[model samples]
Target: MIDTTRLLSGHREGSTLPPLSLDVTKPGNWVVFGPELTAAAGPWGMSFSANLTPDETTGIGSWTEDVFIKTLRTGKHLGMDTGRSILPPMPWYEDLKAVFAYLHSLPPVKNQVPGPVPPDQVMKMLSTQ
Candidate 1:
């Protein structure tokens, strides 16, 4: 059976690579994406996975349920009414409560992920790709 506590907490006790500041050391989880899947980097530039842990100061700990729903529904960052679209490769839609539930249930990790690249740069990269 899956050790959900370890999986959800980002615990990489079995990983080969060293930890990153992006790693949560209290439990020591690595950002281990599968070999077939990769970090998103195309016309939209690069986007790392988000730190969904409930660290109020650094993670989505402040986002309300309404905001989370709006984010999925509108594809806007922080579910802002006018924020940038969630960007490519996300394949998002409405009614993401299960996802939110999983995220909110995790121990609050404090990793600060990078933001999206500028639109112009992404356009340039997309054209090249």
Candidate 2:
């Protein structure tokens, strides 16, 4: 037997922050992370992971602290676009601050996961799972 409430709590909407999009880089590369996983997408043409690293050339170095907040606030690169929706199932609504807070606590690794699948696939992916 187990505590369903506690187990369920782990799955709560704001239980944690989503992936930070890292560069897959090479095969031998080891990404520093805890035991968790989620999906991320953007308009980059291919799948991409967030670059949490502080490296100015490769990671979020250029992103101001406000930019980090906007990632969740506007869900569109701090008003970078005017029409593109951030999509659902990812839950950008709810407590935007929670997500922002979680991401804020990360060490910024350069793991750049693939991003932004094709537009046509977006519908299929979102609709299916």
Candidate 3:
């Protein structure tokens, strides 16, 4: 879970993260997420906005607060040995307990995010300079 206020503020201000073209000024768009990108595109691939809802089978329902903090602090998926490093556009260094608390407060939603795949050399060449 991310602190939407901070993340959106960064986006709005054009901070280090990639610029978000989405118009955040519109009412009710605060919940609006993104257009998912594939990892095969390269290190810069921007995956879809995660299903922050706590569905046990699909979302973060099973994750503990420690894992959440570890994920942000270390940028590793699952915040453990078995997962991959957290990808780009996620400012994993900034861990906000309020974000995790908010996530915990939400009703679980079963949204199965697509698994990321490794990029081939061709895609690597095409997407990156």
Candidate 4:
């Protein structure tokens, strides 16, 4: 027997990981050729996951496909232009083929990624349990 209430409760708290600041997902919870998405959001440590949307401030809500391609392909957010590096588990160089292919196949929805994981806080995140 499925405990509907318990299941729902689990979702409320167990929906994401233990280290992000916000929850970033597209409508329908469907990611085309998605990148690295931890089960739960990380704690609001020194850094948080970018919304990964196209929004100006909160999301990647204003980028071009070409730019997006480079960001993931090189794992250098904005391709060295921004002079910042995306954190680990982004799978930019690792699983890019699928990420690119899937993203290309999905509808271009404007979502915003939250703030970034500051360099100072990056190491702490790695050591966090």
Candidate 5:
């Protein structure tokens, strides 16, 4: 049975470092994507996935449909021009009305994910670990 505990919560655990070689045999060395959409680190540094739940404080509870669509289309946080870039691996898509509806339907999960870490600070963060 699949555990829905952390589903769509983006919960995951492991080293952020890329594997030394392209060895798919080692599952522990790879980064796994959870239903909750957690964090990912690469040459671009660490980026924590945002909580898509309808929680007003931590998630997108306060976001309007227009804001959601614009964020996807423009890749800007809250779809604002002055907001930070949404970062990589987040593909820009069109027509998210249905997607937004479905997301709002789910139970709101209060998960405050960490902010994106710049490339320059990534190594330093790793070194201290």
Candidate 6:
């Protein structure tokens, strides 16, 4: 049986896997999929997975249904016209009202996810390595 609690709570910040190398064609270089989603280091730099629970502070509890739908539909943070692109490997999908409803139904979890690191920073870090 799926542990809905852990699934909804997300993988949390400290549990995130280390940034993956860009050479995904290698045999052992596959991306890992989990409750925290996929964290990829590519041209876009590093993007941490979001906390999908309904926690008011760290999660999506404060988001309106419209905002949720628009975020997925438009791939903009908070669905604002001027908001930064939501970034990938987060895909934009259609028909997510049911998804929105189900996510909101899950118990709120207080996990705080880190934001994305821009490409320049990633390059700088890689150069120093």
Best by lDDT: 6
For residue 94, model 4's alpha carbon misses the true position, in angstroms, by 1.3
- Tell me the whole-model lDDT of each prediction, alpha carbons only: 0.60, 0.52, 0.56, 0.53, 0.67, 0.71
Q: Best candidate per TM-score, number?
A: 6
lDDT of 5 by residue, 2-36 (tens): 45665544434442544433342254455443333
Return the lDDT, model 6, position 21: 51
Clash statistics: count for each candidate:
2, 22, 0, 28, 6, 0
Off by over 4 Å in 2: 1-46, 78-90, 96-129
User: Tens digit of lDDT per residue, candidate 4, span 8-125?
Assistant: 2212332433442233332333222112223332221122345564557655657778888888877787766665776534556778678789889998889898578886997887
Q: Give the TM-score comparing model 1 with the true structure, all chains together.
A: 0.45
Give one digit per residue, the lDDT tens place, for model 6 in 1-129.
666766666446677475455575344554444444545545565666777889898889999999998988888988998999986577675458977998999999999986786857977766888
Candidate number with the higher TM-score (2 or 3)? 3
Please give the range of 10 consecutive residues that has the lowest summed lDDT in model 4.
30-39
Q: Residue-wise lDDT of candidate 2 within 24-102, one digit each (tens)?
A: 3333433333233323333332222344556586566777887777767677744355736555333556686888999
Deviation from native of the Cα of residue 119 in model 5, angstroms:
27
> Could you tell me how far off, in angstroms, the CA of residue 79 lies in candidate 5 after the best superposition?
0.7
Candidates 1 and 6 compared: the better one by lDDT is 6
Better of 2 and 6 by lDDT: 6
State the lDDT at 64 in candidate 2: 89
Residue 101, candidate 6: how far off, in angstroms? Answer: 26
What's the true lDDT of residue 87 in model 1?
63
State the lDDT of candidate 1 residue by residue for 23-104, as single tens digits. Answer: 3323334333333233434444445455466768756788899987888888888898889888656666635788799889
Residue pairs in collision within model 5: 8-35, 8-36, 9-36, 10-36, 10-37, 10-38
Q: What residue pairs are clashing in model 6?
A: none
Model 3 C-alpha lDDT per residue in residues 35-88, reported as the tens digit of each score: 222111223444444444576765678889998778777888888977887765
TM-score of 4: 0.37
